[model samples]
Target: MKKSLEKLLNKPLPVDPFMPQRAVITDIEELAPDHKKFSFAFCDESVNDSWNHIPGQFVMLTVPGAGEIPISICSSPTRKGTVELTVRKVGRKTEVLHRLKPGDYVAIRGPYGNGFPVGIMEGHNVLIIAGGLGIAPLRSLIWYILDRRHRFKEVYILYGTRSYEYVLYKEELKRLRERNDLKCLYTLDKFETEEDRRWADRKGLLTELIPMVELEPSETFVAVCGPPVAYRFIGKELLKHGYPESQIFVSLERKMECGIGKCGHCQIGYKFACIDGPVFPLWDTKNLPEMI
Candidate 1:
């Protein structure tokens, strides 16, 4: 099953999606060096109480004098009143964001884009795969599925990062691996360090972990979020083992430059990444030009 384009087109924002609203950073937790999870509560009490967003959708966060950047929601919609974004300090915009402290203000808006197909995914087996920082958006889906565990049959998480030092949400994921309800498999590119050996399940590229998973291909719906270059290889490996291309969804958050379609930077063929998707079926890369 898939999200219908007709339904998505009919959905409209209650207010202007691009309109910025003020929010204050309530807490900031350092997940790793250069990576921080910032918690925000809308400045207005009503907005803070009513704010909700589907997993995989993103918000345009304006860093005051810096600039606005599209960052995916790393927190679950199941948690209300506050939202969290795990930001990696990579460029000028993020570097500015990282310098800010709790209680600082930022103008933010939009839970834009077609999110994960949670409606149809109920009752199906789910495989969540993340590479490096790709775990950001998928973290929301992971929590959503776990909070409502009875709705789905089986769930698996396969995450790969450069090394033990590069792994995000280290403690949370370590606890998740202890759960009996779902499976969590992790791999690292460098495992020479004793910490890496103690933490990771394997060492190699993420694609190498594919064959180790045991799932019924027809019943499984896979969600992948990672570097764009990994898409082709991940898709190829999944398809090689009988996974359906239509059932595999990939988040293309990197393609988004602006939250509204007015900016042409996120165009892939005729589709606008901001409006049409930040999440798309794996088959779309084959049908749409320059999708990857």
Candidate 2:
């Protein structure tokens, strides 16, 4: 019996190898004042291929002289051929990326980090919260859920920006809100004019609107992405409403080099933000330093 068991365990198992290679930027589009979207296709057609990424996963982008940075996959898996990323021009790498146009070449490392818990979120109401550039990553999960709307109970999206002019995906948000299957809300810190106020749906911080929204804590799962300050405040409000820590997912931003966990730049405690997570359960690392 022992010999038979050993023989079974020794049998070869099939696995797919990870491919890391150069990809060319086939398209680039401006999304907001400081944000741009880049589209890539594999340079080596036979070996390097388009990525298979779960919502919330990110890729490390490298330019020869500028260095590398981890940017989230904003495009949905439902889209084929090319993958897209929305980058805000806030740092050296991004500024370099912003200067590059279509036909430029860049190195792509991975679709790293654990993604949103789609399997667990299925059948539960989803409440997505995004602020500023945070929408770049959360857009993936939102598209995934929208692609298979019937699989979930209800979907609600609340997005906040510093001003009306800073909102991302305004047209897309307006279209999605029209769908009876989903509910969407847009808020700003304050309105700039009477015309802006007429179009503005919600005002004040997003956390303020959270209290008035109707949701069943037991049946709902919340996903939040934003700057560190945004997470600190919104997280506290979510907890106050009795949302379990495990049910709250957050995407953290950090400096990253290699997206394959080979570099220590993105490390937080013992966790590598690029590999172990960019997305983590709120309670999983709530006690870890710099996690907030």
Candidate 3:
């Protein structure tokens, strides 16, 4: 491991962190009514081949006239040459992004934030809990684990959205549900119609699934990403199940400007989300009462 780190540190990066590289949209897939996935390829061959990022990290996507926003990299580094972003049209910049088409160019920089620690997670069972769009970032970690399946133990995924229509990655989740190696359970908050009940595995608050996960707390690592409200409840549920704060990891959503830590937009206590984390062990962040 040390030798690999040395080799990586000795290597030269293809693109500077501060300079935005030209990336062209290669494909676009609408995941939901408001959410879409955009795939990009660097116009420069060198960067396209050498750019690497760990799961849970994010990139600063430029929207030209609208400005830049920090977006989680939904694609894993194992998939070379292209990067992907799953975005929802919620604001001005994103609204502009929604209008983008294949062949259009955008400036991109990063692969920032301290991503999840995959090395420490090796040899342990992993429970991935995502609520709403939280799956966007967790999706990267999920694929990385699946690609290198031999390193980890049992894997379980529980995802919850407001309704069946709001669920992202429908086709991909369907494929995962059919796999024998892992478990996939999806739920909806409001299953008013018969069609909703037929599509989802269950219906209720995502926290309800905690008791259903059958893993030894000591041997499992739980990675959670969701709304701030979900974190408060989920943290308590994991504690009740005997998982230490250290064994639980949470991704906090923050407003970020200048993806590097210069702007204080993403400050939590003394830590900067852009630099210190967007991902932090619950033990590390438990003291920051305001953040949760």
Candidate 4:
């Protein structure tokens, strides 16, 4: 009788929520000509262990005078002690971030936004597509997947850049290719000459290379990260190949002020890019404006 009454109530219980904590910059390194990878160590040791995050989630980085910007958490959760972020010097806030040095203090607000559905993606073939600096965010997902290679099926990565010099994770890509667990492809937009080429792989937009790769649209899950133009074309190509809209995910670039939902700068219709998504299912934005 008591068990039946408990089931009938159907009351939801409250649990602890993930909260943001302050962290300080411990180190910074230049990953590319214009991109800097920053590492932050939490001052409080307890926060370091408690602050759990998933791939594709972003943190709101704050500098005193320059305000804040949402940057993807580039390091995998498997990595402990500190978190990493790769930032391209694109605007004022990033320019300020570039000026920050080791030991300098900075404020962090969150590890916000929905991340890649790793559990759901397990046991399936995965395709990761990244263009230019877009590789920064996708790097997190790639690392996490690589760390737990046995859980998933065949994994493929297609990375494209304007030139060989612009490739973000060249060494890492090469190492990953050597691993039997994954397959990797690197492409460039244009090749100056046969002699000038260091990367002898594919050449052209990422969309063109999609058709050349062998993938089962229904069984494979595609994740793309790039500029607005890249997202538009790559997404269209994936759809043309018969991939389901729900299986395709894209990361968007927006001007994010506050990482929390309170700031309206990054709002798109009813969704806040910082809160609702930086990575979203393709079907969610099929008709949304200024999202692609």
TM-scores, each model vs. reference:
0.93, 0.88, 0.94, 0.88
> After best superposition, candidate 3 residue 83: deviation in angstroms?
0.5
Tell me, by TM-score, which candidate is best. 3
lDDT of 1 by residue, 154-229 (tens): 8999999998998999989999999999999999999889999999899999999999899999999999999999
Candidate numbers, best lDDT first, in rank order: 3, 1, 2, 4
**Displacement of the residue 78 alpha carbon in candidate 3, Å:** 1.3
lDDT of each: 0.89, 0.80, 0.90, 0.79
For model 4, what is the error of residue 184's alpha carbon versus the real structure, in angstroms, after optimal superposition? 0.8
Model 1 quality (TM-score) = 0.93
**In order, what is each prediction's RMSD in angstroms?**
6.1, 6.1, 4.1, 6.7
Off by over 4 Å in 1: 1-16, 255-257
Give the per-residue lDDT of model 3 (tens digit) for 1-292: 5336546787535567788989999999999998999999998766787888989999999997899999999998877879999999999999999999999999999989999888899999999999999999999999999999999999999999988788898889989999999998888999898867977888899999889998899999999998888898999999999987898999987999987999899998899989988998897667988788
At residue 163, candidate 3 shows an lDDT of 86
How well does candidate 3 match the true structure in TM-score terms? Answer: 0.94
Could you tell me the lDDT of residue 289 within candidate 1? 45
| Colliding pairs, model 3 | none
**lDDT over C-alpha atoms for residue 241 of model 1:** 92
**In every candidate, how many clashes are there?**
0, 0, 0, 0
